[model samples]
Target: MKAIVITSPGGPEVLQLQDVEDPSIRDDEVLIQVAATALNRADVGQRLGSYPPPKGASPYPGLECSGTILAVGSSVHRWKPGDQVCALLSGGGYAEKVAVPEGQVLPVPEGVSLRDAGALPEVVCTVWSTVFMMSRLSPGESFLIHGGSSGIGTFAIQIAKHLGVRVFVTAGNEEKLAACKNLGADVCINYKTEDFVARIKEETGGKGGSTLMMLSSQLASVWYDISVWCFDAGVDVILDNVGGPYLQRNLDSLNIGGRLFLIGFVGGAVTEVNLAPLLIKRLTVQAAGLRSRSPENKAEIVKEVEKHVWPAIAAGKVKPVIYKSLPLSEAAEGHRLMESSIHIGKILLIP
Candidate 1:
């Protein structure tokens, strides 16, 4: 198997392609012959040495992939060899072959090409699990998302709109906002030119329901102000991918009895929090990683994919937003593109 490995994280130049031993499948796992893998902000952090694989996890840097099964372990009864699948992986997806627990793999939605299936796993899992499952987003609610042109944002806008939620988004520019609008965002905020908190309050008349933000240092400073944008005692639920100082603000922004689900830390991981606010707000703050979930939890997410995500893709109501695709060997370039922050959606590496 050939894979993109980082010798010393600093820049994209650290990534090198090399031949490696194929992965061995566990009794409950299946081996996939990968066709493509998608890039995420985590990959950039991995390349720069800020993020590393969890203990005993793959050193390779892909988070999701689409491929065909070559072999199945004896414990896998429902699927067999030659099954076309897409999977959420802890790591090791940037290779020709990778093995994963059987329950983590899902059949490609109808009408979706094998190569493009790489775009499905991470975004679908993130949005569905966070926005729908955890936050319990309901129809007629107002949903606000930061980085509206991002892969996560694009998928979120479409899915929330499909569920009858009024969507609001914040992006860096007009072109990005227009892209979000085209994806069904009802209110698009150009964070560069306008204040998202003010606009959201103006649009919702102070009854905003949910807010999703990828953590950033600047966002942390204005966190409470942003929460104020959600009228009617602030937002009820927040899905925060970035942690650090924002953690304190996330708690402050929530309405009484609100919930905050923390999933990532793009910003550095040290921040101070006031415990008193948590008690006063009756807030529920939890930090978790999807990659480390139990096999049963992953299976539940896969089931959710089948029930809620697949149909949207199959019916063309949800579409993968691909910023660019490069050859597998250019995995370095793929990471480079993501770091540049010029792309509007997922960048893929096709083998």
Candidate 2:
């Protein structure tokens, strides 16, 4: 199998196309003839020699893919050869074939294109597992999603909206904000120009503000007002993908009894945290990784997507936000695009 390999830590140029051994199928795994794979921020980090794959995961960089089952393990009962599926991979999705646990695979929803299924698994799994399952985001609750133009952000906005949750998003530009609007983002804040905290308060007439809080410290000055605004408005829950240095602000932005769910530290990892706020406000702080979840837990996420997310796709109320598609040979370019942060959605590589 020909796949992209990161030869050393450096720029996109570090990624080289080479032939590698085909993955052997395990009794609990299925072999997929990959039709497509999608780029992720972690891929770039991996190429830069920063983030290493978890133990026993694929050394390849892709995190999600759409493909056909070529062979199923003897114990794989739910699917067989020739079934079209999208899967969440721990890694190694950038190849012609990758072995996946049967439980991580999902049938392409009705009316969804197989190639576009490349956009589904990672975003759906990440959002559903973090925002809905772990955070307990409910209907009518004010939900603020960062990176609104991102693949995960777009999916989060659509899924929350379909479930009757009030949705807010922060993007880098007006164009990205417009895209969020098309996907039913009630409030779209351009972090490049607008103050999301203040704008969120104004949009919800301060009601949503009181129930949602800011979660990034990279923009402490910018988010300081958010801290004040959300505190004044009384925030209930917050989803923090950028952690580390911002932990203090996340605490400051919360209302009494608010929940802060930390999923990633795209900003920086090390931080000094103060416990006084956590003690006084009775805040619940949680950190998790969906990729490390058990097969049963992953299957539950797949089931949730089937029940809650697929219907929206079938009804055309929400569509996967795809930015571009490149050939498998151009995997480095895919990583380059993701690193540039110019795109507002998923970037797929067709095999």
Candidate 3:
């Protein structure tokens, strides 16, 4: 099997395509002949040596993939060698074949191509878990997502809007904002030229709904400004991906009984957060990671996604936005595109 190996911690140049031993399946796992894999920020972090795979996981960087089952473990009952599936993987999706726990594999949605399904698992599960399940973004409520043109953001805007939530988003430019608006965002702010907080205030009448989603790296530098923004218009729920410097301000930004879902730490991990707001506002803070979750837990998320989200994709109400698709050997180029942050959606690697 040929896999994209991280030669060292650094830039895209360090990713090397090399022959590796085919993965052996555990009793409860399935071997997938990977058709495609998708690029994620986690892959970049892993390639740069900041993120490491969990114990007993693949050393390769891909987090999700689409493929056909090549073999099934003795204990696996729901899948067979001929099944067309897409799976949520902890790692090893950057190869020709990957062994995944049976529970993490899902039948590809009807009408969605096997190649495009590679981009679904990560973004769908991440958004569904954080925005809908954890944050409880109810219909008719105002919802704001940072990085509106991102994979997660693009998916989220569609899902939220489909559910009757008035969506707001911030992007780097007009084109990106227009893209988001076309996806049903009610308000789009060009973060480069406008103050998102002020825009939110103006749009929502100074009572920006209790729910917010932060998926940008820029949060680290503007945490204080956001805190001040929150002082004027309180927030309720925050689906925060960037931790570190944003922690304290996240606490400050919430209204009474606000819940914060911490999903990632692209920003530095170490930081000081004042506890006063937690006590005063009775805020609930919880952190979750999909990759390190138990197989049963992942299976539950997969089941929920299939039941609630898959139909949306099947119906053309929501769709995966693909930026580019390159051959598996050009994995480095995918990483380069991700690092450049020029892509508005998922970048795929076809095997």
Candidate 4:
């Protein structure tokens, strides 16, 4: 099998396509002949030597792929050879073939193409796991997602809309903001030019549902943030990827009892945050990495996604946002596009 190898962890130039030994499947796993794979921010992090694969996981950098089953392990009964599927992977998507646990594999949605299915697993699982399953973002609620033009953001906008939630998004420029808007984002703010906190405040911040209900501090007299109460309690949930730099800002953007889900730290990861808003507003903060999750956990997420999200795609309520497709040997170019952050959505590597 030919896979993209990181000759040495550094720039995109370090990624070299080479013939590698074929993957050996476990009893509960299946071998897939890759059709396509998608690029993710984590791939760049791994190439820079900051994020290494979990112990015993694939050494390559792809997190998701769409492929045809070549062989299924003895323990895997649900899938068979020739079945077309997409899978949430810990790594190894950047190859002609890779091994995956059967439970982590998903049948391609009725309306999505085989190649586009490669972009769905990671973003859909990540969004569903964090924003819906964990955060409990319900219908009629207002949700805000940062990086609205990125792969996750674009999908988040559509799914949120499909679920009858008001969506707010932040992008770096007008073009990205426009793309987000067309995808059903209600409020689009350019983080590069405006203060998102202030924008969110202006858009949804209203008389915060009786301030007394949100007060939890003994020093309640000093807890009055007029700006917060002047508008509303902000949004019901926030999905953030900017990490450390936007930590405090994310808390401020949420309503009382609001939930914040973090999946990445594209900006620097370390930052000093004021803990006041968290306590005052009763915010829930959580961060997770798909690659680090146990296979069983990923399976659970994959199951929930197929059950809850597949219909949305099949119904044409949600769609894959693909920016570009490159050959497997051009994996380096895919990384360069992702790192440049110029692309509005998922970039695929065709094998």
Candidate 5:
């Protein structure tokens, strides 16, 4: 099989496609002939030598893919050869074939094409696990997600709206923010121009200044003072990937009992923060990674996503956001595009 090999830890130019040994499946795994794979921030980090695949995982960089099942191990059930599926993988997606634990495979949703399915597993599983499953985000609650036009952010907005939450997002420009808006983001904040914290506070009307509290008695006053008094509220939950620089602001943006789920540290991993807001807001801060989780844990998340999220996709309420598709040999270009941050959503690599 052919795969993208990291010639060395350096730049995108180091990613070279070359012949490699074909993968063999374990007793509980399935071998998939890759149709498409997606670019993720972790893939770039892996290429740069900052992040490496976990032990026992494939050495290649891709973390998710969609393909047809070519063979299944003896212990595997529920799928067979020729079955079309997408999977969350630890590595090896930058190849023509990848062996994945059977539990991680997901049937392509009814309306999504097999190629587009490649973009779903990672962002969906990440958002579903962290925001809805872990944070317990409920309908009518207000939620804020940074990088609103990103792969994670675009999907998060649709699913959050599908579940009836009011969505808020922060992007770098008007084009990205407009894209986020069309996808159902209720409040769009351009982080480069607007103060997200102030925008969120104004829209949600903080714990101490909830507009709902005075809606009935002060309806007229609210209409008159909406602009002046609205900038104090906070959201019920926040989903953030940019860590460090966002820690203090994310904490300050939450409601009294808000939850903030962190899936990455794109903004740098360390920062000094005032811990007082944590106590004042009674906040819950959590950070997690999908690649390092055990197969059994990942299986649980895949099942929940199948049960809840698949329906939304099938019903046309949620859809895959693919920005571009490139040949697998051009994995380097995919990495370059992702790093440039000009694309609005997920980028794909076809094998």
Candidate 6:
């Protein structure tokens, strides 16, 4: 099998496609012949040496993939050889073959292509777990997501809108903002030129609602400012993907009894956080990472996603937004596109 290996990670140029031994499966895992995989910011962070794969995970960088089952371990009963599936992976999705825990595998949605299914697992699980499960965003609530044109942002917008939430998004430019609007974002703020806090306040009439989702890498620099705005607007639940400097602001942004779910540390891993807001507001801050979770935990999230989100995709109420597809050998190019932040949705690597 061939896989993308980060050789002394530095830049996209460091990713090398090389032949490697195929992975073997555990009793509860399945071996998949990957059809496609999707690029994510985590991959870029890994490539640049900022993020490392969890202990015992594959050295390869892919986090989600779609493929056919080649074999199943003795305890795997939900699927069989030849079954079409997509999986949320801890790593090794960049290869032609990977062994995945049965719990993380999902049957491809009825109407979606096998290749496109690769794009769904990561974004869907991320959004459903953070926004719906953790944040408890309900119908008629106002929801705001940064980087509205991103894979997670795009999916979050559609899912929130489908559930009757009014959606607001911040994008870098008019084109991305327009794309977000077409995906049901009620208010689109051009973060590069305009003030998102002001626009969000204006759009929600000074009450920003309960749930806020942050997906932008720029969150570290502006999280404090955003937090002050959230404080004024009464934000109660925040799903944050950018960590470091944003931790304190995340606490400050929440109303009394607010909950903050931290999922990623794209900006930086270390920062100083004020403890006053936490004690004064009685806020709860929890951190989660899918790639490092136990199989049982991942299975729970996959089960919820399959039960709740797959139906939406099958019914056309929500769909995977793919920006480009390249051959598996072009994994470096995929990383480049992801880092450039010019693409509007997921970028797939066909294997």
lDDT winner among the candidates?
5
What's the ranking of the predictions by lDDT, best on top?
5, 4, 6, 3, 2, 1
Better of 4 and 5 by TM-score: 4
TM-score of 1: 0.86
- The TM-score that candidate 4 achieves is 0.93
Query: Candidate 6: where is the Cα deviation over 4 Å?
Result: 207-232, 244-258, 269-283
Model 5 scores a TM of 0.93
* Deviation from truth (RMSD, Å), model 3: 6.8
Q: Which ranges of candidate 2 are over 4 A from the true structure?
A: 204-230, 272-280
lDDT of each: 0.79, 0.81, 0.83, 0.90, 0.91, 0.83
Measured against the true structure, the TM-scores of the candidates, in listed sequence, are: 0.86, 0.88, 0.88, 0.93, 0.93, 0.87
lDDT of 4 by residue, 1-351 (tens): 899999997999999999899999999999999999999998998999999999998998899999999999999999999999999999999999999999999999999999999999999999999999999999999999999999999999999999999999999999999999999999999888998887777788553333333333346466553223322558999998889999988887887899999898888789998776676678899998888999989999999999999999999999999999999999988888888889999999998
Better of 3 and 4 by TM-score: 4
Question: Which residue window of length 10 is worst by lDDT in model 6?
Answer: 223-232
Q: What residue runs in model 5 are displaced by over 4 Å at the alpha carbon? A: 206-232
- lDDT for predicted candidate 1 compared with the true structure: 0.79
Query: 257-318 in candidate 2: lDDT tens per residue?
Result: 76778878998889887666675567788888876677788888888877877888889877
After superposing candidate 1 on the true structure, give the runs of residues whose Cα lies further than 4 Å from its correct spot: 207-235, 244-258, 270-283
Per residue, candidate 6 scores C-alpha lDDT tens digits across 65-157 of 999999999998889999999999999999999999999999999899999999999889988888888878888776667678999999999
Best by TM-score: 4
Q: What is the lDDT of residue 39 in candidate 6?
A: 91
Instruction: Report the error of model 4 at residue 336, Å.
Output: 1.1
Clashing pairs in 2: 210-233, 210-234, 210-235, 211-235, 211-236, 212-235
Clashes per candidate, residues 3 or more apart or on different chains: 1, 6, 2, 4, 4, 0
- Candidate 3 Cα misplacement greater than 4 A, ranges: 207-235, 245-256, 270-281
Residue pairs in collision within model 6 = none
